[model samples]
Target: MHTFSRADFERFGQLYDIEFRFPAIHGDNSTDDYIVARGEITEHSLASGFRFTFSSLEVLEAYDSVSCGHAPLLVLVVLDGIVRLTLGSVEHELTPGTAVSMQLHPDYPLQAHQPEQQHLEIMALAFDPRRAKLGHVSPSLHGLTILPRMPLRQWKVPHALQQLLRTYAGLTMTGTQKNLVLEGVALQLAGLGLGSEEQESPDVPVVPVQQRQRLELVRQHLEFTPDHDHSLKDLAQMAAMSPSGLRAKFRAMYGVPVFDYLRKCRLQLAKHYLEQGFSVEQCANKVGYTHATNFSTAFRREFGFSPRQRTVDQKK
Candidate 1:
């Protein structure tokens, strides 16, 4: 077992990013801000790694597009702001109050976009399932319960779970205190994410290749027309799928229930509008919210802040 108190986040971001689409990252990652990505590794038997981080990169900027292909399964929780991720052909809008379990199982391409100059905070936990060759006589790899074996499953992170992650991220405790606290919290979070797997079972039939293609069409439609009036019947009719099948398969493939995904899209569009000088009312209308008050409440609940708090920030 090993503990790393201060870890380099941007450096690790490169371990995946630089290899794919990003050429370089530029921002003020001075000494103080540069090394807060922390983790603990227990490699005695099973090669297990857990990292819980709250990274705020001031003046953070990325040059070029993100083209991540085939990254392993991990639990990603967005605590603030929005992160747009394209996994395979299905694009997902990850906002606060949302969590997803996705695996980069060979050739599954992922492209992520967070508006430049918008600070984002997230907690990502990575664990390896492979066993170590020489450690504690090699046993108990399956005992690790936090690792997601099911691949691409997404669900909402409960408020209590969100609080736990935030507490761990902001902890001033160090040395053994940090390690003890982190391992417990990380495992707990993982277990919570795994609980979402009960939604899938032997009862639900697998989606066919052609229906999956139709679902892709539906995904593209939502992406392009985030504000359009969409109904489940209309969407299922368009996709040529039974309503029930469409609902189940959509959640299976995209990790979000249909209505939930729609809300994510609407709020994400609202984020763009608010950040672009639109008044709360105007933005609310643009995203199809009937009232500004309702929109504000939803936005606050989603991203941890009110729309009034965001300025029409131009890149400085």
Candidate 2:
């Protein structure tokens, strides 16, 4: 995390024309200006070869009358005070320890209203979804996506994300390192958004007992023989189900499909082996890849870093 003193903040305020007021909306007498105190922008790279940005803003009694828009996904963490956010017909009242996310586009209008005698402190991160690799696997998240505003009590922030945010606040990182950190933050956020929903609601569907047994059997078989070149048909036969049924059931049970989960498990094993100082070829073979290049490509695609690059990053 980069720290900006008052002087540094003043310079930024002057540069960006901060504290400017806009016209009143709906005939309200309240002021429409925003006072930005401090902020920082940073980026991070992921093992999956993606880069993202993490940014934060500290403000006091900020208000936006004129609707402004953003292109990336915007996640706002309200640390203090109350902020009234209106998106389309929805109105979200955000308070301390609240998080609200929205897909920012040109058409959406966002207005902020802060009552007098109170200060609003918010930290926000914006990132492009295209570069985040969210679209490739989850087509439903391909476009602008907005997560409902949730209190911290309802949705617990993962420890990894919390640590990344802390690192963003203090680390004296270079541009490349910043990108890496941002990417890490994005990955963590995505995991939180996609992973937690299933665990939160038990009503969604579960695999039948027989199917669950088959899936567990397949996982155990993979663990026992990681190098086996088993096809979907073979796994489906082992599960006593058709390939399509297997895919659907696995996706319902887990967030990802069976093959994707298998690949991810293999890549995680490869990463562990690599971290233990195993050679690239050894890690590749241990993870069921016949060719080292194939493993390298898959590792990069999944984690945003090649095995060699990850090793170097781990050392650093």
Who wins the lDDT comparison? Answer: 1
- RMSD (CA, Å), candidate 2 to true, equals 20.4
What would the TM-scores of all predictions be? Answer: 0.46, 0.39
- The TM-score measured for candidate 2 stands at 0.39
Per-residue lDDT for 118-168 in model 1, tens only?
545677665454422345321433434322334346789889888877665
Candidate 2: residue 40 Cα off by (Å): 6.6
How far does residue 146 in candidate 1 sit from its true spot (Å)?
Answer: 12
Cα lDDT, model 1, residue 140 = 34
C-alpha displacement of 184 in model 2, angstroms?
0.9
The reply for model 1, stretches above 4 Å from the true place, is 1-14, 17-47, 59-72, 131-150, 196-316
